[model samples]
Target: MTDVIVGAALVRAGKLLAQQRAWPERHAGQWELPGGRVEPGESEEDALARECREELDVAVSVGGRVGADVPLGPAKVLRIYAAGLVSPGDEPRAVEHSAVRWLGLDDLDDLDWLPADRVLLPAVRTLLAGSFSSLSTAQDGL
Candidate 1:
């Protein structure tokens, strides 16, 4: 099976953005990170932005991959990104979600994340220790 690369964005400010799955979906009723399938010819950054807009109806500033659950060949790969809302009106619109909520990290395990994302839970916690995303070393000059 070809591994699908999906973007997983965790909105900060003491809460992780989660969305309830629509009925008949693979993970229906479960709360998962808001994102979508990466499109062809699109960079991960662009894909992340587009996915956020389509899934949550919000604009987000794409950040680094704080965590990634990439299985060996044929297994699915989920790239977890550290992103922030671009505006004050960043609340979810539920275009693709049944419901959305701001959840604390401690409540993460309570939600039913996809298998790959569940594996990345630990890494996500670690990244949360720092603020937002990391600045590129190359950008230290600026």
Candidate 2:
């Protein structure tokens, strides 16, 4: 069976969170979503939440799947999901990455994303657009 790696498209306000890889000379400095492998017997959502806590020191509420499965070599595949902070006021820290940034729609394209993550931009774009609209609606109600 193929191993599944889950990525969190963690969004807040009108931005999406991205992390920069810190190690492995080949992938260093490249950006990607915060996530890790889904362990045996753990549901994808549970794994994602756990990963966020481990990698970002934040609690996330996993939502629906965001994009298609991206094949990673022969035995692994990447799946992304929409997620949000359990406490909207909470900030995420980069525990495992070199750095973390919240990228707006305009900022997404410029980052040097990891190969698997680059392909998911369209779906992430759609997700962020929706987030922007929701933020606008909420602000307008104020």
Candidate 3:
């Protein structure tokens, strides 16, 4: 059976959470959405939530599925899902990542996203607008 990997796109107030890789030197410093492979008997949404809790130390509400599946390897496919924090004040602490940042629309394309994840940027942009709104909203305190 094929292995399914889930990626989380958590947006808040015009910003999307992005995580930088820390290990396997080759992919280190490059950004990828926070998630991991789903284990046997685990649902995809559950896997995503578990991944966030393990990697970021936060709880997230998994929303709609995002863009097309991204090829991670011969056996893995990376699929992203839209998410929001269960609590606004619960900031994600990057326990497994080198760093974490909240990225706005203008800042999306500039980051060196992992090859598998870059394909989802367009969908991510759309998701961000719905959940976080615009730059003006961020300024107006929405």
Q: Rate the local accuracy (lDDT) of all candidates.
A: 0.71, 0.96, 0.90
Clashes of each: 0, 0, 0
Q: List the RMSD of every prediction in angstroms.
A: 5.3, 0.8, 2.5
Q: Per-candidate TM vs. native?
A: 0.79, 0.97, 0.90
| lDDT by residue for model 2 (1-142), tens | 9999999999998899999999898999999999999999999999999999999999999999998999998999999999999999999999989999999999999999999999999999999999999899999999
Return the TM-score for candidate 3, rounded to 2 decimals.
Answer: 0.90
lDDT of candidate 1 over 112-139, digit per residue (tens): 8766667777877676545333333335
lDDT, candidate 3, 1-142, per-residue tens: 7899999998887699999999889999999899998999999999999999999999999998999888877887889998889998999988999999999888998889988889899999888777665556666885
Candidate of highest TM-score: 2
Models sorted by lDDT, best on top: 2, 3, 1
RMSD of 1: 5.3
